[model samples]
Target: MHTTPLTADLVRGALDLERTEHGLLPHRLPARARAQCADPQLHLAESQPSGVRLVFRTRAGTVELDTLPTKRVYVGAPPRPDGVYDLLVDGRPAGSASVTGGNTLTIDMAAGTAEQRPGPVGTVRFTGLPATVKDVEIWLPHNETTELVALRTDAPVEPVPDRGRRVWLHHGSSISHGSDAASPTTTWPALAASLGGVELINLGLGGSALLDPFTARTLRDTPADLISVKLGINLVNTDLMRLRAFGPAVHGFLDTVREGRPDTPLLVVSPILCPIHEDTPGPCAPDFGALSSGRLRFRATGDPAERAHGKLTLGVIRDELARIARQRAAEDPHLYYLDGRDLYGEADSAELPLPDDLHPDAATHRRIGERFAALAFAPGGPFADRAV
Candidate 1:
């Protein structure tokens, strides 16, 4: 087969790109923003490219992609499943694939050290596509850091022209990063983007959605028709800040974003229901008993009484977010608030419990995606007609 190489110019949705010795590494955060953060967790999450994808027009019957996926391994924890790559043809699901033989980043949480082991690249090939020319989208793995080594197709490919849809830029933690979701496209944010008919630039960095100034600056600089920032959960889980700092941090984050997009419709979403952290603070620790049984679960390690001393909890964060949104809305009509509980509340939790006691399962991702579309993007909703 005469193969044609697909380069970075043919890819869409990645915020930034870095050329590595092996190939092109797509980054969800721009270089300026990434340069400001030295946190290892943020470094890993932002480079994973959760919503970034390669979209093009092709008539090729066969497509092949070679990637160097950096898979994470926790020394004492159960191994994670391979991240999935989803292929969409003409806006419909066509097939899926997973890569193997990539580098490994092994972390010993107890020892607090991480080691990298280099490995060979792997290829994912799809054959037997329809002969007619059509749009093709290969969604990168949401959970793994993938370095695109090469792309080859039997026929030449061209970057898909902009569809003129509104760009929805969203930032949040792992739940928004597709944690435990079945595939890249099925993540709540992805599903919501599809249903809402918008282009998604997801900045849902897993375990890394602290309201950092750099992140807010990135948002301020990015162009988007609609935007949202889901806050609180990661902060609580890491116990990164106290109540005193959180309010100002949230304000500063929003203030920075507004500086660039003063009139854009911006929605602030609070964290969804997490029973373990509802009243109690966190430092969420793993449930070893569950882990021993090959199940992953988490329990809040902080005492509820600590809230009196300004330790933050999910409930407290929710109140502050609502208060901030309301106070700011008085001057900014484009700014709106959507309680996270509206998407997934205590009532929904009883029926569809979070398997990990932190992130929602696949079913819940669909539910939340559907509810978000209805509440935020439906007619008269904050984002309604904005994408159109």
Candidate 2:
């Protein structure tokens, strides 16, 4: 039902993939040599005095992960060689382990956390995952820089089987990155994936969905049966570029994704409503005093008063996205548009206020997740029964 692309790029990573009669198999790179051409790493930074923190979602079932020794280590003070790591999984006190210098460890079901025991890079194994691991969350000890060098999962990810459900690939900003959400499983994207009952490849980089061409190329090369791109908010919040460049960038981004997934159900989503960007673009800054006092507050230099002077408004972004979608749909019927406001807007906020005026709170995540499932995964909508 799906057509393979003419060609594919070999991604750089130290991951090995194998397919057999049962399912896809994953193996860590062998010692003394990298399994993937490039390193598989997740970088987390702690600018403030507090230690750095790392959190991610993983299934709770039989799925497992091997955490390689974190290199490029970061700490404010002279490195503490034998610091205790207080690890929390899914908000629960899973376990605590002594972090020794120059060793990797593995955390799993039966064995909570074990040092790699002086073999190659010590491995930290995460096992005893939930059977229905909708998401995985990890909270690292505070005040130190943490770099996740490697993560390998048992995803049964053999090449697409002849008779398996399709995978949904999603790209977005912080919202998609599980910001302000209680846990990884609670992120709207994760929730949507669970309800849709599809494999997920989430490329939601917090504060980094800038419609970069390299990112577009990443999407273009990645295989998918369905794809959705959430845009606008990050561009406006950061004021990364003016309206002049945003439009063309959207066009180019979609164009790249289509290179490999020509007929895939591609949906472009504009920003959900934000008061700061309602009438003008924002370089939003919260009151530092309020922040110190534990009170959340945000202010915009480009308020409604400055709208006449030229600010980025949510309406402006929404309209531009619609324009882009219409322009492309003329040539590609598979392209679709979903106004993000339809998911959350001033109206929803009126009922359930956001924790901080910008990010949606926990309740809102559930609400939006349900709404998205209804629209994107309904029995027979435009996306339903479609193929890549």
Candidate 3:
């Protein structure tokens, strides 16, 4: 090995290296923040770009490679409401813990199980790291749809790098999250990240992307380089709001994201195809006959006549997003919009039926992720004008 003199200038330059303190970095942080690699906050939007890096490192062997630390939390009830969180060491099922208000949950690999006791949400410390362990991979048990309150860990914090790559913060319903998709890595956003080659901060909050102001504020307060908002489906499915509230809520949602990401690229996307609402507005109900026949179908809940004007369905949402985009374009030329049909419209669904009426399976998720990356990250794409 060639040996060069250890010079004072080399040390000076190395010490001078600095990254802006932001995003996910490794270091001694608040116990809650350190427990997870990235800040445990969700910023909802429509779509995400790719090609950004968020790196976290731990002392080699200092973190146990086979034991996972508790870093996930689920609020409210999910499809599987058995446990609030689970710990997986090295991607294998290790154990689980339950959350009761103000209760302390512990996972001690040394003890070979998890235990819950009365206490408050706080830092979680894991002993017996291999001392040669270089990193820890975290698997979030909850779907992307859920919100996060805190994270606690035992690593020193590092600064999040700008990396000169565009950051896409997206908000959408379950489809955006890993919903019916096979695994977390297969989620549309994750696939999009791999394809688009940009940094991502996903806020695909499963069923709650109803243009809630709190969700919007979450976006508003967070930082991003690019942003998008995917709307429709959820509101129609849940029958959450009427036309009056939907339109204004969308506008409000966009406005809120702008508060923090001023001058950032923003796109508004409508919902993809759903046959029942292709033309009619709706609180679309499951078709009993179709259910019995094992075909996915939906019907208007209210009067057939009223269905035409009552709520915003997939089609209606597309139209409204176009209108909204056009209306806002003069004021903000950087803002762009994409029709949901541009994604998986009726034809695509016909060929690839979603196993569930509400969520797309892994295949569809991959398809959508690829399509999104091609459009948003391709040369001269809608996001092309922005610095990416």
The TM-score leader among the candidates is 1
lDDT of each: 0.91, 0.56, 0.54
Instruction: Report the number of backbone clashes for model 2.
Output: 34
Task: For candidate 1, write residues 1-388 as lDDT tens digits.
Answer: 5454556667777888899998899999999888897999899998887888989898899999999999999776789888899999999999999998899999866567999999999998888999889999999999899999888888888888889889999999999998989999999999999999999999999999999999999999999999999999999999999999999999999999999999999999999999999999989877877766766788999999999999999999999999999999999999999999999998999999998899999999999999999998899999999435
Task: Provide the clashing-pair count of each candidate structure.
Answer: 0, 34, 45
lDDT of 2 by residue, 292-361 (tens): 5555556555666544544556788889899989999999988989989889977897997766677887
Q: What TM-score would each prediction reach against the true structure?
A: 0.97, 0.63, 0.62
Q: What's the lDDT of the predicted structure labeled candidate 2?
A: 0.56
Candidates ranked by lDDT, best first? Answer: 1, 2, 3
Which model is ahead, 1 or 3, in terms of lDDT? 1
Instruction: Rank the candidate models, highest TM-score first.
Output: 1, 2, 3
Judging by lDDT against the true structure, name the best candidate: 1
User: Candidate 3 on 166-236: residue-level lDDT in tens?
Assistant: 66677787777566665545678867865776656666655556776666776676566678888888787
Question: What's model 1's lDDT at 248?
Answer: 93
